[model samples]
Target: MSHSHSPVSAPATNGHDLAARIAELLTQIDTVKAEYATLDKRANEVAGQLAQRFPVYDELYMSAATEYNRAQADLARTKQADTEPDIPLDDAEKASTPNQAVRSELSGSTHNAPISVNKLYRRIAQLAHPDKTDDSNKHTLFLEAKEAKKQGVLSELIRILALLTGDETRPEQLSQHQGQDALAEKLSRINVLRKELTLYRSQLMQLRNSPMARIVDLISTNTTLSITKAETLYKMTILQRVKELETNTSGIRQDIAFQSNMNKT
Candidate 1:
């Protein structure tokens, strides 16, 4: 069995301490998820308020935008279809294109994950013993465990072992093999959480930079600004965009109608 433990800084840190660290990390990740949700809700609320003030126009503007996008896509597709027959790929281009390139790659050797050893993997090996796989799923679980161990991913092994053995194994129960594998699993989870946090923050920043969010911030920034005044300010800003979309949508519909007539002729 491959040991798939991620390295926890102190190789000797007891399983109990590692579990505590894992708890702290999960709590922090959940907090970040909550923070992102709050800001997303705020941005949506601002949009809703604008829609409420301009109910009819709001619907028209959205409908028009969708129609405009669809027409533009259709136009592009039509142009491509009309011109594609005149241009044939050369020998080099044909070899590099999907039909040839993808087939060539598919005929090569399959890449495999690296393998290491761990106690949890040992436990998985025992539980998923080939001789005792009458449960049908046991063999599948064994393969998954083997793969996880090879990948040095103890967390996946832990999950599979729990399913095979029907035991709710906690982080502490996995303290075997000198706390190596479990510690690695904790670090893996932490690294994943850190990446998730970065992604969430980036999304939040994008929302903040959007026109609707900026308008909301601007109206709310003045502590003395009256509720009526703020409402008016939001409506005034969106009204211009709504008019622009209306014009664009009209133009797109006209173009689409002209194209349809030309196609028939």
Candidate 2:
């Protein structure tokens, strides 16, 4: 009774067991945290893929929509133009007017390549000659041809006109053939060609002033803008040709002045 039975060692054993249980629980918690981190990373990757795919899908849809709208607008415009009433042809007026020649040349050019300018003028004169019978169709054709010849058909129209008129001269050989009769014919054709050239110049100016031309300029100036090399080359060629023509004309003028002064002396 005196030495109270030494306290049983059970409490110590129980404390050791409790500490072991806590360490096991902490290890399990760490494992769960690692698994959660993995899950979070996978979820983020899936979200990024969805975001990237949706924008591209939407852009494709928008592009398709724009194309469809453009097609619809073009269709509607074509239909409207088709439904309009046509103007009746005036037989006598058309026969008397200069436009008849133009119409004929336009039709002929559609069927064949452009005729030479000298030839075109000759053919027109033949058709319009007073000795020819007064055929309304022929008259209209002659006038149109004359008008077209005048506009700048000299190079191509002349060839066609010369062929029709039974003339053998080509544009390049014009200066060599200086006989009075040849000069007269050449002078007449030159006048017409000048007029046509003026109209073409006007058309070129109109194109230069167009919004499309502005866009082309923008594309040329901006490094990031998309444009084909061929288009740029074509524009350059056109400009070069214009410059060449101006130089040639200036030389011709100087020659004419020199010839005139020599003749006067």
Candidate 3:
């Protein structure tokens, strides 16, 4: 009796072919990077021409330059991934306190709030800073909130501070914290994207070493035909592993959303 083999199972049969496929993918990645770099260079040249033709087009030129740099960075990242397939992404660090977030806002302002860090610390402490809070729960929340702001949980930190300081009734007053919160959210999204990219790189490596290569080895070794069924089972195993990566990416996205919502508070 003869059994049919799946197309996906074919790749699981041999080492040489598996390695060749991986090498092909790496080549493709390199080709894409080269193409992107060429396009980016052309974009910058165009942007320069625009700037020369009309000084008022400075904003347009700047925007074009920004896009070109973004492309360049993306291509650089792809090249790095091809060179080092196993690089892992680091998680974003958590924020410190609402005061810290406000300080960041202050630093960005043309009119700096003369609120000295130490003075601000003392004044804020009088209201809701952990040292001033007598209730244990409020104190704990205050400390956590402060640390979150310091680490960069700007929105959550600010909201907590506002609630503790009797500013919860005035949501508009919390606008300063909004900018920081937005920045934190962006950083969190960046971290998730990096991790997703890393997972894809790892998946590429796994596909290169899949069970299809092992089945091929068995065939080359003149193994009995009965073991072909076993090879198909091995292909299922690799598919399951890839599924695990997909699940992980989903979880990371959920975490990013949760973090964003937490900041809005």
lDDT of 1: 0.53
lDDT for predicted candidate 3 compared with the true structure:
0.40
TM-score winner between candidates 1 and 3: 1
Which candidate, 2 or 3, has the higher lDDT?
A: 2
After superposition, the stretches of candidate 2 with alpha carbons farther than 4 Å from their true spots are 1-179, 223-265
Estimate, for each residue in 88-174, the C-alpha lDDT of model 3 and write its tens digit. 121111112222221122112111221122332333445664445567756665666556645654334444545566644233333
lDDT of each: 0.53, 0.41, 0.40
Tens-digit lDDT track of model 2 for 1-265: 3765567743343334544644555454445434433333332333233325444433333343333334434433433344422222222112222222212221122112222344445546555543453767455546666566558544445434444455544434544564345454554454435434443444344434433344345444646534444234334433443455356445545554555565566
Error of 3 at 112 (Å): 34
How far in Å is the alpha carbon of 264 misplaced in model 1? 17
TM-score of 2: 0.25
TM-score of each model, in listed order: 0.41, 0.25, 0.23
Q: Which lDDT tens digits does candidate 1 get at residues 164-244?
A: 666433345444633657675665455444544554455556555555555557556766654456566555654665566
Ranking of all predicted structures according to lDDT, beginning with the best and ending with the worst: 1, 2, 3
Q: Which stretches of candidate 3 lie over 4 Å from their true place?
A: 1-11, 59-265
Q: Which is the winner by lDDT between candidate 1 and candidate 2?
A: 1
User: Among all windows of ten consecutive residues in candidate 3, which has the lowest summed lDDT?
Assistant: 102-111
Backbone steric clashes in candidate 2, count: 29
